[model samples]
Structure formats: structure tokens, C-alpha cells
Target: MNITFQKNAVTLLGTPLKEGEKMPDFTVCDNSLQEVKGGDLSGVRIFAVVPSLDTGVCDLEIKRFNEKASQYPDVKLYAVSLDLPFAQARWCGANGVNAVTTLSDYRERDFGRVTGTLIQELSLLTRAIFLVDDDNVVRYVEYVPEITDHPDYDTLEQKLNQVIRAQ
Candidate 1:
């Protein structure tokens, strides 16, 4: 059987996201199953945090960022993952991840296709981070080449600081 997958206009998986690109509006489900859309973050600096909560690296990434989220009071952090809402809620509950808002894109294919994070032959999202300003412009993006590796937190922190300072 031949299968064709949808491709994004931009390939972000192995490349750094350019600054000034407007982020595509997307709707994802929150832990409570309520729809969370990009419009809800119009005036907030958003961190599009992607991970696979079931994996060790992803768990550590979420935990680390959740801890750092407290320091960035002006920034809104959203932990985006492919895990089901129930699993995400359970994981956050057990890990005490109250600082960052966890969102799941499992129900929709927008995130995976629009962001180019969906693995070609797998049901997993690539480890990546996207920093969007209040105007919804993508300021910084990092796509870890190796799915098993963690993102560079220091670099992300620095960029986030820049965004905060600019605001």
C-alpha cells in the first residue's frame, strides 16, 4: 500500500526556525479536554513546549521547564505533547507540574503537520521548542535532531529572556 503524508510548508525538524515568522493558529486540547487555541494567547508570550511524556528525556524536559516556569512570570508556558489528556494529567499530577500548562495535540493533526514534528513512520512527535511573542511571531525555535536527546535549555532560556526584556 502506498501512503502519502501531508507536508508542512516549512521544514522545521532539522532547521532553526527563522525569527519573524508568524505562527500558524492551531487548536489543541487541554488536560480537561477543553479546546485551547492560539487565539487564547494573543497577548502572551508563549513557549510551545513539545515532548513525549512517556519517555525519560521528555519527562525530564517537562519537569525542568516546569521548575523554570515560575521564574518567567510574564511568559505563558504550554507543555505540548502527543500523550493523551488523561496520561498528561496523571503525569503532571504525580510530578507536581503546576507551573506550566500542559496541552495535548493528540486529537488533531495540525501541530504535527504544521510544525513538521511528526515522525514519518512513527506515531511520535519530535523534541522541539518554539518561542512565540505576544504578536504570535516566532522568535526562536529549536528542533533536537535526535529524538532521544534533550533540548538546549540554556539557549532557550537566553532567547526567552530576550523576549521578556523586549516586552
Candidate 2:
């Protein structure tokens, strides 16, 4: 899909995963540099894809989600980024962001490619949000048209509530 990056044209490779589609499994590294595959994650997952954690908007977005994640213990809020595992750990520790688990896709960009969030020019994942059920089926997806903007958290919260209630 073609998503705008600060209103500039950018090409996102692969087909975007949508609602009701089973999320494809992929492996990514966590803070400890341990491989974490999609199957390794249990319960409902709320994936927040960001290009990088060093930027202002991405940092704020991650912090916001980290705070809101405490409300839903059953849901795993994954902050996906292209940052290295060491950098991710440092950022989490420095920012006191413990609620959301930070994942590193720097090695392979598997998550980016699978979700169709990879920016071809920048080689980074675009800002997006995905809600996958316990069954691994996607329940909601939000591809932010602009890379620097925040996601629609209100809609995300509503969808999360509905998905949780249905389960």
C-alpha cells in the first residue's frame, strides 16, 4: 500500500494485513536479543509499529501506549521498531516504559514486511497499529496516513473493548 510520509509519497511493500485475516507468523528480537516469534506470544496482541524510538513523536506514542496498556493486562501491547535491541532496552529503561514490551525488527524487518508497514526509501516501518486476537486473526488495523502523526487511540480503545468482550 502507498502511505504518505509527512505528505510525501512513500511505497509500502507487501499486502497490508486487514481485519479477519490470520496474522502471519514471524520472528523478532526482544530487548534481551532473544528470538520471539508470533507463536511465542500469547493472548490478544496490540502491535504499535513505529519507524524508530529515538524520534519525538515515536517516543511519545510509545509512552502513551505504555501507560494505556496497564489498563488491559490480558492484552500484550508490543512496541515494534527498527531500533536495535540494546537501544530499545536503553530507551525503555531510561523512559521507565515497562508496561509495553519493546520488540526489535532491525535484524530482519520481518514484522514490517509482514504487516506491509515497511518504508522502501527509509527502510523503516511506518506508523501503524494492529490488533490481533488470541487466535492470531487480525481484528483491527490502522495505517496512519502520515508517519509523524499519532494513531487514533479512541478508535483503538473501542475496538479493543469489543474484541475483549467478544472473547
Candidate 3:
């Protein structure tokens, strides 16, 4: 069974995305499994952090961002993963992570597909970071090519600062 992976030139995951482009609206599940849509997050800068959450790098990334999220109270940080809502809640509870909002995209919402983070053969979401402005415009995007690598935090932080300053 040769499954042809639908590739999009959007970014690393082959989803069609570009810098300065308006981000597409989406609805994902929050920690409580409640529906969370893009509109619900209007008027706030969004730090969309995609991670597998089952790997060491992903764990570190979330931990680091969770700590840093506190410094930017104005921004809404969302840690997105394909993990089930139950797993997300359990992880948050076990780790005492409450600073950043945790979201799950595994309810057939195709968030991984839309974000271009879905691994074609592995059924996993690739690690990516998208910084969206309050108006839902994509200001910055970083998709690490290697699954084991971490995102470029320096550049991401720089763009985040710029967006915050612009507001």
C-alpha cells in the first residue's frame, strides 16, 4: 500500500503557509476537552507551540516555554499536541504546568494536517512554532526540519518581542 503523502509547500509539514499571511481559523480541544476556536482567542497574540509531547525534546520545549510564558502575560501561549485530551490533562497535572494553555488536536480536526505538522507515515505532528498577531496574522513561523531538533527560540522570541512592541 503506497500511500502518497499529500505535500504542501506551506512549511515543513507541506501545509501551504507563508510569512505575513493571515492564519487560517481553526477549532481545537482545550485541556478540559472544550472546543477552542481561533475567534475565542481574538485580541491576543498567540504563541502556537506544536510538540509531540512524548519525546524528550518536546518535553523540554514545553517546560521551557511554560516558564517563559509567565513573562509575557499579554500573550496567549498555546501548547498544541496530537496527544489525547486525557493525556494532556494528566501531563499538566503531573508536571504542575498551568502557565500556558494546553491543546489537543487529535479529535479528527485535522489540525496537524492544516498546520502542516502531520507526519505522513508516522501519524504524529511535527514540531513547529507559529506566532500569530492579535488579528490572526502569522508574524513568525519556525518548523524544524529534523524531528529531534528544537525550534529556533532566539528568532522566535525576537519576532514575538517585535509583535508585542507593535501593539
Candidate 4:
């Protein structure tokens, strides 16, 4: 699906992940620059995709998730972005963000291309969220229609609650 950035139409590369489909395989870098693959993560996971950590919208998204994460200890929160691992680490440290782990898609657009969150024009990820259950099936997917807008946190929280209850 096409989305807008700063109110201008922009293309998102690859097919967006759909609910009930098996989560696609992809790799992202951690703060330490180690490769993290989707297949390696188990249990309920939330991929909080974003463009850059430095941006206000992305910063708020990650901070919100980090704060919300304490309420759902069982769910693993991942903030995926195109920012460098070092930058992510710095942001986390400066902001006291520990509950949510940050993953960088810089080395390769592996996660970006597969999740279809990669913005073709900017080569950055579009804001989106995905809930993957323990079985690796996608339970929820949300792609912000506007790049600058915040996600529907209410709906996302509701879905997460349902997933936790089932777990």
C-alpha cells in the first residue's frame, strides 16, 4: 500500500506483511552490531518499525513502546529503523530506554525489504507495527497511512492484550 511522508505520496517497497501469514525471514543489527534474524526470535514479539530514531515521531514511538513494555513483560519489543547501531545505542542511553530493544536495518535492507516498510524515496522505513505470535504467525499488522502521524496505539494495545491473554 502507498503512504504519505510529510503529506507527499511515497512508495513503500515490497509487499506489506499480512495477518495470519508466517513472518518473513529478515535480519537487523542490534546495538552491538550483531545480526538479529527474525527466525531467531521466539514468543510474542512486536516489531515497532520506524524511519529514524532521531526524528520526533520515531522518538516518541520508541519511548511510548518502552514505557508500555513494562506492562507486558512477556512480549518482546523491537524498534526497527535504518539508523546506525551506534546511533540507536546512544539514543537508548540518553533516553533511558531499556525495555524496548532497538534494531538497525542499515547493513542490509533485509528487514526493510521483507517487511515492505522500506520507503523507496528515502531508503528509510515507514512507521508500522507487527505482532508475531510464538508460532511465528502474524497476528496484527499496522502501517501508518501517514509517515508523520503516530500509530493507532489504542487498537495496537487492544490486539496485544488479546495476544497476551491467549499466551
Q: What are the C-alpha RMSDs, in order, of all predicted structures?
A: 5.5, 0.9, 4.6, 0.7
Please give the CA lDDT of all the candidate structures: 0.73, 0.91, 0.73, 0.93
Residue 3 displacement in candidate 2 (angstroms): 1.1
> Please, what are the lDDT tens digits per residue for candidate 2 over residues 1-167?
55788789999976799899999888899999999998778789999999999999999999998888779989999999999999999999999999999999998888888889889988999999999988888999999989989999999999999999999
Clashing pairs in 2: none
> Sorted by lDDT, highest first, which candidate order results?
4, 2, 1, 3
Error of 4 at 93 (Å): 0.2
Off by over 4 Å in 4: none
TM-score of each: 0.85, 0.97, 0.86, 0.98
Q: In lDDT terms, how accurate is model 2?
A: 0.91
TM value for model 4:
0.98
Off by over 4 Å in 1: 1-17, 44-51
Which candidate wins on TM-score? 4
Superior candidate under TM-score, 3 versus 4: 4
Structure candidate 3, residue pairs in collision: 8-14, 10-15, 10-16, 10-17
TM-score ranking of the models: 4, 2, 3, 1
Give residue 31's error in model 4 in angstroms. 0.8
Q: Which ten residues in a row have the lowest lDDT in candidate 3?
A: 1-10
The better candidate by TM-score, 2 or 3, is: 2
Model 4 C-alpha lDDT per residue in residues 1-167, reported as the tens digit of each score: 76999899999998899999999999889999898988999999999999999999999989999999879998999999999999999999999999999999999898989989989899999999999998999999999999999999999999988988887
Clashes of 4: 0
